[model samples]
Target: MDIDLTRTDIIKIVQYAVGGRVSLIGVNLSGLDLSKLKLSSVDFSFACLKNVIFSRANLCHSKFQEVDAENTIFHDATVSE
Candidate 1:
């Protein structure tokens, strides 16, 4: 299952899902404000996260392969070791 989402809507949705588990696979969230959100175990492998703001977002166990992250903000994001 896949859904099309805009930057603003995606941010809002992600914000609500913060501190909880949510799946955002294949969602187009390019250039969105994803900062201050705490996501765990989410699979964003093929999502368009280009220029997306992930500053300070908790991305533990999250996947980001094949995603366009050029110019994206991830100052303090945490990835799997």
Candidate 2:
């Protein structure tokens, strides 16, 4: 299923991931800011993250399997396997 989320909604979801994991599978988040957010262990498998800026964001242990991340920026972002 395709899911659409507003910026505010995305922020809320990231906040909710503070103590756990947030699954954003198959969600289209093209051109979103997504900067400076804490998103540890988040699942973004198959999500469309084109042109999304992840500057300074904490994305440790997050999964981006098969995600469409063309032009996505990860400046200063933390990521792990």
Candidate 3:
């Protein structure tokens, strides 16, 4: 199921996430601009990220297993592992 989330909603999720780890399994984040945000250590397995913008965001150690990330932008983003 696709979740309709605004930037504010996403921030709330991140804030309450345990130990900077976000579980985004099977979540659809298509067309959402999550630029310049701190989203490190998020698990994006089985997620749909079509057209999602993650420019300048911190994404180190975030997992993308089986994710659909077509046209997703990671411009100047920090990513590792």
Overall local distance difference test of candidate 1: 0.73
**Candidate whose TM-score is highest:** 3
Worst 10-residue stretch by lDDT in candidate 1? 1-10
Per-residue lDDT of model 2, residues 1-81, tens digit only: 243876688779877665687999999988888898887888999999988899999999999999999999999999988
lDDT (CA) for every model shown?
0.73, 0.88, 0.88
Q: Which parts of model 2 are misplaced by more than 4 Å?
A: 1-3, 17-19
Of candidates 3 and 2, the better by TM-score: 3
Candidate 3 C-alpha lDDT tens digits along 1-81: 465676787889999987778887888888899999899888889988999999999999899999999999999999998
**TM-score per candidate:** 0.72, 0.88, 0.90
Ranking by TM-score: 3, 2, 1
By lDDT, is 1 or 3 better? 3
Q: What TM-score does prediction 3 earn? A: 0.90
RMSD of each: 4.1, 2.5, 1.6
How displaced is residue 75 in candidate 1, in Å? 0.4
Positional deviation of residue 72's Cα in model 2 after best superposition, in angstroms: 0.3
The C-alpha local distance difference test score for the whole of candidate 2 amounts to 0.88
